[model samples]
Target: MSGSRPAATATAAAPARPGGGMRPGGPGGPFGGMAGPPQKPLNFGPSAKRLVGRLAPERLGVMLVVVLTVVSVALNAIGPRLLGHGTDLIFQGIIGRQLPEGVTRDQAVENLRADGQNTFADMITGMSVMPGQGIDFGALQSVLLGVLALYVGASLFMWLQAYLLNDIVQRTVFRLRSDVEDKIHRLPLKYFDVNARGDVLSRVTNDIDNVSQSLQQTLSQLLNSLLTVVGVLAMMLWISPLLALIALATIPLSLIITTLVAKRSQQQFVAQWAHTGALNGQIEEAYTGHALVKVFGRQREVEQSFGAKNDELFQASFGAQFVSGLIMPAMFFLGNLNYVAIAVVGGLRVASGTMTLGEVQAFVQYTRQFTQPLTQVASMANVLQSGVASAERVFELLDEPEQVPDSTDPATLDRQPRGRVEFEHVSFSYDPDQPLIEDLSLVAEPGRTVAIVGPTGAGKTTLVNLIMRFYELQGGRITIDGRDIAELSRDELRSNIGMVLQDTWLFGGTIRENLAYGDPTASEAQIRAAAEATYVDRFVHSLPGGYDTVIDEEGDNISAGEKQLLTIARAFLADPAILILDEATSSVDTRTEVLVQHAMAALRSDRTSFVIAHRLSTIRDADLILVMRDGAIVEQGSHTELLERRGAYFDLYNSQFALPAVEE
Candidate 1:
C-alpha cells in the first residue's frame, strides 16, 4: 500500500523531491513499509468491555432482549420434561397391559419381585401403570400438545429477542459512526499531516463497518448460547445428576481449546486490521499522486511496495482465520464425545431400573442442549476476536487529541475595517528546536501589497499558515487593524481574509457553482463578472456548456491554467478585507498571467494583500517587498529600491531573469 510521498518535516530545510519521492520501505529500503511496526493486540477484556459500553444508550433495549432470551431458554428447558412425561405414559401402559386384569399395580410389582425380577419391579413401581390399560391416550395427547406449545413459545421469544437485538446493535453502531465523524473534524490538522491519511480513513470507515457486522452477527447469538447453556444444564441435572456429570465432563476441554486458540488468533487479527489500514494508506497515496509517480518512473518501485504490504495483510488474515477456525472443529469433536458418554451412561441407568426409560431419554436430550451452546460459543471466538480488534482501532482514532478549544469570549470587529496588518516580534517553528521564523516583525499599511519572496523551505507557506491560525505561534502576535488576531475567533478572523494557494482545488460541480463558492450569496451576474475579470470566462465559454460546464473532482476536464484561472476568479468573488496569493499565478501561461495580473490589481486596490511570489516581475509594483531567507527577513524595500541596492533581492532577480547565453 505504500508509495513515495514526502512527509511533512519539522522544517523544510532541504529541497523537496521534484515529484512525490519514493516512500521508504520500498524495494530499495527496509521491510515493513505498509505499517510502521506491528502493534500488540489490545487487551481483550478491556477492549470488549469498552465496546460493550457503547450499548449503554440502548440499555433498555438490551435489558428487554435479556429478559426475552431468558424466557425463551426457560420455555425451551420445559420441552424435555413434557416429552419425558409422555414417554412414561406409553411405557407404563405397555407394561400394564400384559399384567392380570384384576391385579393392582402393587400386586403386580410384588409378583415380579417374588419371581426375582427386582429391577423390573422397581421400574414398574416408578410409573402409575393401571394393570388393564393399554395406553393413556388422553394424558399422552395433553403432554404432546404441551411440548409443542413450549417449543413454539420458545421459538417466538427467541425471534423477538433477535429482532430487538438487531435494532439495538444498529443504533449503537450508528452512534459510533457519528462520533467518529465528529472526531475526525475536531482533530488537529497535524494528525493528518503526520499520519497516513489512508490508514486513518480505513479506521474510520472499514474498521467501524467490521465492528458493526461482527456485533450484528454474533452479539445476540452469543447471549442466547450462554443462557441456553445455563438453562439446559439445570434441566439435565434435574433429569439425572449422573448423566449431567457426564455432559459436564467435556466442557473443560472445550474451554481450554477455545482459550488457547483465541489467544494466538488475537495477535493475528490485530495484525490483519493494522495491515489493512497500512495498505489503504498506500493505495490512497499512490492514486493521489499517480501522475507524479508515473512521471518519475517509480511505478515499479511503488508496485513492489504495494505488493509487500498486501502480502503482509494476506498472511495476517490467513493466520488469524486459520488459527481461530480450529476452535469449531475441536468443539464439535468434544461435543460429540460428550453425547456418546451421556447416552451410554443413561442407557446403563435405564437398564439397571434405577431410572425409567423416559427419564433416560430426557437426560439424553438435555445433554445435546448443553453441549450445543458450548459449541456455539466456541464457534464465535473468531468473530469476537476480529470484531474487538477492529473496535480497538476505532477507539484509537476517537481518542486522538482534538484541536485547541476556541476562545470562550471572542473579540468583535468593525463591519469592514481598513486592513492594516502588523507582525510584531513573531516567532514560529514547525519544531520547537528548529526555529524557522524568529522575531520576524513587519508592518503592512492599509491598502498595501506586501510581497514575500523567498527560496523554497524559507517558511513562505508556513508563514501564511501561521497568519491563518492553521497553526499556533511559538512567540509574538499578529494583528489586524491594531487589534490582536488571537483575540478574534478563528471564524471571524478567517472571514476577513481570502487565500488562493498555488494548487487549484475545484468541487465536483458546474463552473458557475465553483465560482459561487467564493461567496455563496453572490448573484449570477456578479459570478460572471468575476470570471470575466480573471479570464476564466475565456476557456469556460469555449467549453460546450460554457459557465455551466461541470468540473469533475480532480478538475481534469479543464487545463491546468484554466483551473488556476477559476480559482483566481473565485478568490476575486470573495472581496475580503485581506487577501493572500501564494504563487497564485504559477500555473498560468504568460498571456493568462498578464490578464490575471490586471484582475489582481483591481482586487488588491483597497485590501491589504500579502503576496508570496517567486516570479520577480509580478511583484515590481508591490508597495513593499520583503526578502526572506531561512525564515528571517534579510532585506525589505520597494522592488525598485531593492534592485537599486544591488543586495540579496538584486541577486535573486538576476538569477531568475538572467538573459540566456547566445548560441556559440
Candidate 2:
C-alpha cells in the first residue's frame, strides 16, 4: 500500500467509475481505501510465460498428470473406433459381403458371415476368430478378460491425473498467499492511514480465491481441449479426407466468435472482481464500525452505499456470463451444420463406391469430438482471464517498495543504554508544504520524565513518532544514545523502548498469552508481580479463570480501564530503557486513573519517559514540559518555569486542573 496518508490528490487522480461509479465497469477502484504498491496493466505475455516456466521446475506431479491424460484419452478414443468397426462387420454380414478379386460372391458372403459371428461369439462366449470360419470359445473368454485389463489401465491413469491436478493448484495458491502475507507485514505504518483493513483482507481472501478457482477449472480444460482437438482432427483426415475438409471449414468462424466472447467476458470479469472487493470492504467497514453507524443514525446511508456496490457486482457478473455463455449454443449449431454437410457429401461418395459407410460413420463421430474440445477451450478462456487479473493484483503487492530497509550497516550501541536522546534542527512534515516541526531542537537525558502537551492536531504524537523513527525526518536527524537512529537496526531500536497506546489492542487468546507477549521468557511469578504492580491483580484475581481467561476480539469482555492496566502490566514487564505513554489514562475513571498514575510512577523510576497528555495532573511532576501548537513547540521548560512564564502551558494547566474537588 502507499506508505503515506491518503491525500486529496489520491481521490482526484483515481480512474473514472463505470457509469460514473455506479457499475463495476468503472475504473478499477473497488479497493478504494486500500492502496497497493502502484499498479500497472495486467500483462500475461512474457512475464506470465516466465512465471509458468518457474513453476514447471517444481511440477513433477504435473508431468505425470499429463502422461496419464494422454494415455486415458488415447485408450478411450481407440476403444470406440474398434467397437464401431465390429458393428460395421456385423452389418456387412447381414448383406452378403462383396467379393474380393480372388473370391466369388458366395464364398465372400460365407467368409464375412464367419468373421462377424466369430467377433460376436468372442464378445459373448469368450472366443477368438480363427482363420477360415473356425472360432474357439476359450479364446473368446480371454478377449473378455482383456477388456477388463484395458478398463483398469484407463481408471488408474484417471486417478493419477486427478491427484496431481489438485496438488499443483493447492501448492501454487499456498505460495501466493504466503508472499502476500509477508508483504503486508513489511509495509510502513503510514500505509494503514490510507487503506482500510477490510480492503486489504479482500485481496488476501476473495481475490486469491478467484485465482485458485480459475487455476483448478482452466488447467484441466486446457489439456483436454488441445489433445482432443488434435486427436479427433487427425482421425477425421484418416477416415475420409473430403468429409474432413468440409468439417474444417467451420473452424475459422467458430474461432472468431469464441475470441470475441472471450475478450468481452475478460473485461466484464475484471469489473466483476473489482466490484466484489468493494462490496466486501463496505460490509467489513459497517461491521467494524457498527457502533458509530448506530450513534450517528446513518444506517440508511450505509445500506444505500453497500447496495450500490452489490448491484455493480451483479451487473458485471451477469454481463460477463451472458456474453460468454453464447459460445456453447453457437458451437453446437455450427457443429450440426457440419454434420449435415458431411452426411450429404459423404453419402453420395459412398453411393459411387468412393467411400464406405463405416468410414462415413467414423468421420461424423470425429467431427463431433473435435467440436467438443473446441467448446471446452472457449468456455475455459473466461476462467483463464480471471486468473490473470488476480495474478496482476498479487504481483502488484509483491513489487511494493518497503518502508524500512533491513539495515545492511547497523550501528551498535554501548553495552548499557544511557537513555540519552537528541533531536537536532528536526524539521518534518506529512506533506512538504506544511512543516510539523520546523527546525526544532530538543534533548532529554537519562531518567527524566518529559511531558508533551498540545491541542488536537498540534503534532504531539508526531514528535514521539520521530523519536521512535516510525517515519524518517525530512530535514534533521535523531540520535539515540549518541548514535544516529537511522544507523541502528529497527529491531534493536524498538527493543529498547516500550509504549502504551491510547487504544489497547489484544488478540483472541488467553490473558496469560497477551501478558506474556511483552516478555515471552518471563516466569509466572514475574508475570504476577508485574500485574500486581499495575493493580491488574485486583480484577484478574476476581475472575474465575484469572490469567487463563481467554480474551475475545480486542478484549471486549474487559472494561477499558482494566484493558489499559493489563497493557501497562505488559509494558512494565518489558522493562525498557525508554517508555512512551500516549493518552494511557484517558478512558479510566478518576479513581482508576489515580491507581494507574501511581503504577506508572513506580514503573518510571530510572527510565527515560515521554508522556503525552492533556490532563495537567499527569504532568505536574515532569522534569520538563513542551507545549505545542500547530506542529511546533510554542513553549518549553520545567513545570515551575513554564507556570512562571504564564504562556500557553500556564493557560492549559489552569483550565485543566483548576476545578474544585472533595479532598482526598
Which numbered prediction scores highest in TM-score against the true structure? Answer: 1
Clashing pairs in 2: 17-26, 18-26, 126-140, 126-141, 127-139, 127-140, 127-141, 128-140
Task: List residue ranges in candidate 2 displaced over 4 A.
Answer: 1-57, 97-151, 655-664
- List of clashing residue pairs for candidate 1: 1-282, 4-23
lDDT of 2 by residue, 125-228 (tens): 21112223322335445544555666678778777787788788888888888878988878775554444555567778887898888778887778867877
| Best model per lDDT | 1
Candidate 2 minimal-lDDT segment of 10 residues = 1-10
Residue-by-residue lDDT tens digits, candidate 1, 308-350: 8889899999999999999989988888888788778777777
* Candidate 2 lDDT score at position 574: 89
Per-candidate TM-scores read 0.91, 0.84
- The superposed Cα distance between candidate 2 and the true structure at residue 341, in angstroms, equals 2.9
What RMSD value applies to candidate 1? Answer: 5.4
